[model samples]
Target: MSDVFSGVYEINSPDVVSEYFEDQAVILNLATGHYYSLGGIAGSLWGLLIGGHATDAILENLAAQQPQLVEGASAFVAELISFGLIRQARAGAPGMSIDVAWTSEAPKLEVFEDLAELIAADPVHDVDLEAGWPVLRPQS
Candidate 1:
């Protein structure tokens, strides 16, 4: 992986909610009770983030997995930050990257709701969304 492709992030889904499918780029934030979903190119970038990949590494990986989205990775990442889906680690760490973790608490709801809406409205009804939706998956 390149400088842009090193780090890891995890996507979390709600344990109580049950309205969406798996494979959707939906995440919930227990701290803020917010929901977020990354569809299309944004979805890919979100995946990279959850994988614990650094921002740069995310861009590089996305460039390869989704060439058409390479150009938009930077902006998309910025948007994700603005949306509070991700955050930087330390203030001055080299290769400092954002980390995404999954939560099942009530307070955290940033990514879950957004992802649910996306899954319900997916025009293509992509199977990937089915795999990502935590609600649709069998309980462990």
Candidate 2:
């Protein structure tokens, strides 16, 4: 496998769900029942990544503007990859045209495991009709 980090990337979907609210983002991996939060530079980078900007393009632009943040940005990307939240973009994928303005602060990824059991709960079939979702049916 290639580790050059020179291609566009996309969200690992189906099992992963994410929402960006204002300056922050919340990402949940349904497969593992773990969630993550991103703020500051990390959120901005995630916005760009999901927006279809090429990894190399983002890094190059950041390097041209900030220079010092290249290392941190790369590490952030690596961390995202390690978390299985993103994957390389498919061929002929359309790219985003918008520009990304990153903050001076380093990127940060906050992982949360407190909600694993809650997230893993099956709201569809495991719920009591009287209590509705989030209320598991009593085991017989």
Candidate 3:
């Protein structure tokens, strides 16, 4: 781990919102309207990231639980950064490390663009006055 990624991270707020359900995490980037699904190990990793744990601490914790996952941790966090869902926090917060049980599953970030246009549309301002609040303008 030469390039030991340091610092904690925070979700891109005011534009991104995420919720974890069961073993999956649903993250929506309102500005882009591209939602992502992260399940299993990826979902658990996300929880840890948002928990404000330092990257090095997170990797160390995950590696302790599942040595194999450390190899993918950097890429997983990179993917999250590329998607504009999270960014390195200016001031790191003190937090706990990963707590999920070890697993061999490879972390993944599943992206969906099916409802991008609709999701990005402003329901309160982009709706047709005659058609009502729920009726949004057709995809352009």
Candidate 4:
């Protein structure tokens, strides 16, 4: 509970995206191009975590629903942190918000390492460099 994120955790931006199907989920880290799949009660916890629940509350709620998950949930959360999917929320910085259909089975967060290169690029960038916008005049 003393982890840096105990205060708050937000999804790493410009780097991650998540989609859920019922209680299952697919998460993509655009920067690394690595996508993750989560399901069971773990996916449900993800929804709460991203929805702005502090770590303690999420763990408490989920652990109450599925006592066996008390051990794995922490590990899974650590994985999320290591994968750069979630991090300490900065003051007033909004965390991820998603529509999650809750489930109460078990907890698990899976990573697919081979698909990074295949996932199409998400180019997040600055419009202006050192000075002004580069002219995009059409050929004429």
Candidate 5:
């Protein structure tokens, strides 16, 4: 079974269209017509924001899947928090909030899953799961 922080992201389903970066495999989400870039270690971190994994579990999964990036995880996470892309879930939740920035009404849960699958399949740059994080190239 996947852990809380398995880097598995889902979409808000309510509003947003995401695409992979051209120069790098990093993913970018355009929410409320705003662009959010998620690359290198942050790309994986963004994946978790979609809501499948718990914060701690996602961290644990990151450690197991990409040990090298583990050292940078905290800092990367901090940046995400600062960007308002991610926020504390609630007073007592074990997860963070992912601002999907839906302009319209919220979508059904299944739609989010579908979006996740699409994003996973179409990374901005090529990815090798067994390898460490991909080097984020300059955007063209």
Candidate 6:
């Protein structure tokens, strides 16, 4: 739990892709076919965590920059954990750059977990030859 913040975490899957917006981000898990949208301060935290900053260090930086975040950072990171967006590493990861860019805003972790069912079926393999693409029958 707290280990997600006390130690080091990294994106363990090569299939994961992230796209950032102004203060939000969308992460896609190609393998699981699940997409996630991270908004508010959760976006900033995602960049730092993936950049290899240790848990405590990121918390320190977040606390220093946005004291308001200190209260809920743990729960947010836990959410990231449950979503499988981040994983603990055997050793502390390097590349600790805490100078994350962005204006301070209220911190909240909003995870959109409704994409799995939409993407779990393989279009290329599961679609009917007559129906073509965009015609997958949802996997059960």
Tens-digit lDDT string for candidate 4 (14-132): 67888887647889988886788887767776766776777766665555556666567777888898888987776432343434334555677777767564354322232233443
> Of the candidates shown, which would achieve the greatest TM-score relative to the real structure?
3
TM-score of 5: 0.40
> Which of the numbered candidates is closest to the native, going by highest lDDT?
3
Per-candidate TM equals: 0.43, 0.81, 0.87, 0.69, 0.40, 0.79
Clashes of each: 40, 0, 0, 1, 7, 1
In model 5, what lDDT does residue 97 have? 48
Clashes of 6: 1
Q: Show model 6 residue runs off by greater than 4 Å.
A: 1-4, 94-97, 101-103, 137-140
lDDT of 1 at 113: 51
lDDT of 1 at 120: 48
Query: Deviation in angstroms for 9 in model 5?
Result: 11
- Which digits, one per residue and each the tens of the lDDT, describe model 1 over residues 1-140? 33232344333333212223464555555445455654554554565555455566655545554555554556566555565556554322346453423222111123445445444433444335466633343334
Order of models, best lDDT first: 3, 2, 6, 4, 1, 5
Overall local distance difference test of candidate 5: 0.44
**lDDT (CA) per prediction:** 0.47, 0.81, 0.82, 0.66, 0.44, 0.72
RMSD (CA, Å), candidate 3 to true, equals: 2.2
Question: Each candidate: RMSD to true structure?
Answer: 14.5, 3.3, 2.2, 8.7, 17.1, 3.0
For model 2 the local lDDT of residue 104 reads: 82
RMSD of 2: 3.3
Angstrom error at residue 26, model 6: 0.7
Whole-structure CA lDDT of model 2:
0.81
lDDT of 2 by residue, 1-140 (tens): 12447788888898788998776898999988899998668888888887788887788778777778878888889988898999877852445554767668888889999878768778888789898977778889
Q: Candidate 1, after superposition: displacement of residue 35 in Å?
A: 1.6
What ranges in model 4 sit over 4 Å off? Answer: 1-5, 92-104, 120-140
